[model samples]
Target: MVDFNVRLGLTPTDLELREIQTKRPAEFEALSADDSPELRLVEAQFAGKIVSSRLFRGEKTITVKKDKIVAIAKALRDDQETAYNYLSDLTCVDLLKVNKTEEEPRFEVIYNLYSLATFERLRLKAQVTEDDPTIDTVESVWPNANWNEREVFDMFGITFNNHSDLRRILMPDDWVGNPLRKDYPLGGEEVEFTYNVRGR
Candidate 1:
């Protein structure tokens, strides 16, 4: 057993800190290495579908075409060698002002998958253009995607085709705009105070 003695504002000793830091790089290197079996499996399974792959800080992120997401997701979930059974999270990113140097798409729907048995994680991104911001639903592959997909749709206006019930999960059904988008209006509702109430 190990004792961390973790408490608010409590500083760890140099030896303890060094020990923790020393183990992180080795773990990261193991995951980020090109020889990982899971990585090879992913490459083999989705060869043509993969648009780009990147490794940053010991984490792998793979970008794929929006249309091929469902097939790729199904492979990741059902494959015994790469059983990414847990859908840890699903979200979208509005790349309106991001990576201006590259001609990347306007939006990207991201899926975080985890393997409870193997204790591994993978990140998959499917790019969606502003003109046609839609992707096939992964709800069939991972049922939890139902709510996560709805949240992404509500926040980024990205549609998930064949989703059981795609609707706004966080915002009102009549909300004017996707607040999370970079170009969303900054201010809208009027501030209310006791003085303002008296005037009204």
Candidate 2:
């Protein structure tokens, strides 16, 4: 038997330390203070809608309320100053096991946006509670969100309101549970084998 275990050699903390050390002083300061230009713009435009923001490894992520995501998405795309015209990806994260305190919501719908002119990227996260795991669809702003949203729905059971065809893209319609959810069971069936010999 071949050993398939492989090590990356460095831990996540090491990677984070390296990122911090490699950044310029000004850039490091900006990240530390949460004062990036894009973050400032988002705060200024969507003050009340934004719940929280964080910077990690030079990447900024803004979290918004589920109900306010559509308006924020529209502004991010249509606003001249922050013309994030591209919706690179849309997905969901199940936070049931990740949030030990259970103070946060059960699901997070993530939107990866990009600007063609500025060549910048931003990640928008909207929290959805287990009781109400639904959010407004962004397919109106970017057509590509249709399939991505479907996949998220199929995997996480996070519904996207106003989606044209909100059906399972990867899993079958008869599928019982969302596979990606943390509480979902790891299911497998036992196999039986029988051997017979006629002549030895």
Candidate 3:
């Protein structure tokens, strides 16, 4: 078994430091929105659109209203200065039990983007409540989001509005529940061995 400390090429001291940092988020140095040029560009271009932004450990993440995802995505792709033309990955996170306090909008849809020419990366996020777990699709901005959005829908039940073909890409058409959900029951579905044997 690989040692946890060495697994990440980190020494024991480095692992301890990382653990401390993880536990103490307040100690994280908060950089102003203008500190990041990309963020500044976004703030200027899309005024009043950003909900929150973070620059931690050299990574940037911005949260925006769910309704404006498509517009902002298009801007990121088309904007000459912030040419984030590549959608690296699209996924969702269930924040049901992970949040310390009772945070609204139990799910967050994440979009990872990259600018090939500049080699700059950015992450965009939108929060949707469990009651209305849906967000605007970015398929118009990035055609590749078709399958990624479908997988998120299949695994988390977060619908992507205006998606051309938003169906289950991983699960069966008749699957009952979203398995990736935090509240989804463990090993709830019994294997239909009898049906398989009969068919055989």
Count clashes in each candidate, considering only residues at least 3 apart in sequence or on different chains: 0, 0, 0
Q: What digit string (tens of lDDT, one per residue) describes model 1 on residues 1-200?
A: 11223322245563245445534332332333264555576678767776777666767778788877888888887888779999999999887754454567899899988999788888889999998988999988999999999999998998889889998988878876787897663443344476777646
Ranking by lDDT: 3, 1, 2
> In model 1, which regions exceed 4 Å deviation?
1-33, 190-200
Model 3's lDDT to the true fold? 0.81
Q: Best by lDDT, which number?
A: 3
Candidate 2: tens digits of C-alpha lDDT, residues 90-163: 88888775524667888889998899977888889998999988899999889999999999999999889999
Worst 10 residues of 3 by lDDT: 1-10
Residue 68, candidate 2: C-alpha displacement in angstroms:
1.4
Q: Number of the top candidate by TM-score?
A: 3
- The candidate with the higher TM-score, 1 or 3, is 3
Q: Hey, what RMSD does candidate 1 come out at?
A: 11.2
Error of 3 at 81 (Å): 1.7
The deviation in Å at residue 105 for candidate 3 is 1.3
